[model samples]
Target: MIPRVPRLQVTELVLDNCRSSNGEIEGLNDSFKELQFLSMANVELTSLAKLPTLSKLRKLELSDNVISGGLEVLAERCPNLTYLNLSGNKIKDLGTVEALQNLKNLKSLDLFNCEITNLEDYRDSIFELLQQITYLDGFDQEDNEAPDSEDDDDEGDEDDDDDENEAGPPGEYEEDDDEDDGASDLGEGEEEEEVGLSYLMKEEIQDEEDDDDYVEGGDEEEEAEGVRGEKRKREPEDEGEEEED
Candidate 1:
């Protein structure tokens, strides 16, 4: 329980891996008036309710929570929040993302291991929706591959044109080629090369994910272990006093 001081001056609070649930932190607002930075990561929170509305709050870390609703509440209650970490949640709704559009000052947002990250063009859509977000899921928009370079597009178009010239009613090219079999053979070889290049280009576009999305969830277990280790540490005096008694 937070002590009822005359005027609370506490600013930073780190309550990571506390096994906290919904509504458990509702009473904090009544105590901590000047609170700013808050970290409640891995707390098993399913809903973001009753969060203290400290307008001075600039950073919030609710990572690994089971938050499925109340994103709008955070955006509304903490309008001044600049950094938010919601990684490892099961937030599947895009509307939750739309809710964050109100956070005009939000600079960094982490949504790693969340279901929303699996959607098609997920990062692009989020980037378009939240222009103020500088870093998203541990990456910047600049890191994504360009749709297609101008040179690649020009080469693709040229290849398509060559294929179109070679492709016609089945016998049309054959009739033209009968007069000069050698020339026709050469043309066919070039057509094959063009088709092969076009196929490769298509493959490259499909492989765009290889360049765009970088998975980095390998250290999650280590982070959880660190949090647990912190929770298990005992005060040296408390441990030794029992032995003396």
Candidate 2:
């Protein structure tokens, strides 16, 4: 027997492969008042007569069992069940599956590997009969895939959180803008320095040209002075020759 705890606080229970019927478990019905999920898969349960009245139960697993009929008890005991897996069971006929119609809250049901699945119009008939169910086995009436399990949902939630964290705070974008601005300013400063250097080079070239012109002018003035001196000496010699004559 499973050890007892605060059973009323229990929201989930798994008795899979226990080789016992629902009635065999002591205090399952009375103890688990808050139970919302239950799994009795492969437990060799032939009937649900002794199943607990779990109005809060939303999901139940009874796969791979010998349960052939008497599914109406589920509608009575777990009226709020949204998901039920009765796959790999002995359910053979559409009439037997019709018993689930009473479960108004049932949105998903699995009867895979069952004899009923081999029926000619099994998929069509089940959809027509259970109009409220969004998924039969794993597909909807329109053949759309069903949503993933809760564990997958949790993983998706974690991925979303990681994405949010990777995105970082809003201020991060502002920091990037500031860095771009700094780079732009640095580039402009470099451009200004290049221009200043070009201007200085032009000034130096102009000064060099002026110095060359000054040197040429000085040479020309010295040549003119030398010519005047020669002319003066020649005039003096001419006067002396005339006197001698």
Alpha carbon deviation, residue 198, candidate 2 (Å): 28
Provide the overall lDDT of each model, using Cα atoms, as 2-decimal numbers.
0.78, 0.88
Our tally of clashes for model 1 stands at 0
- How accurate locally is residue 176 in candidate 1, as Cα lDDT from 0 to 100? 60
lDDT for position 38 in model 2: 92
- Residue 106, candidate 1: Cα error in Å is 0.4
Best by TM-score: 2
- Point out where model 1 deviates above 4 Å: 1-7, 21-27, 144-245
lDDT digits (tens) for residues 1-245 of candidate 1: 97655537788888887886453564466466677789988888887767767787888998887887678887778888878889898788688878898998887788889999999999888998899987787667987433323346789999988887779656777866776998878899999999999999999987885655433343666788888777667566577889999
Residue-pair clashes per prediction, in order, are 0, 0
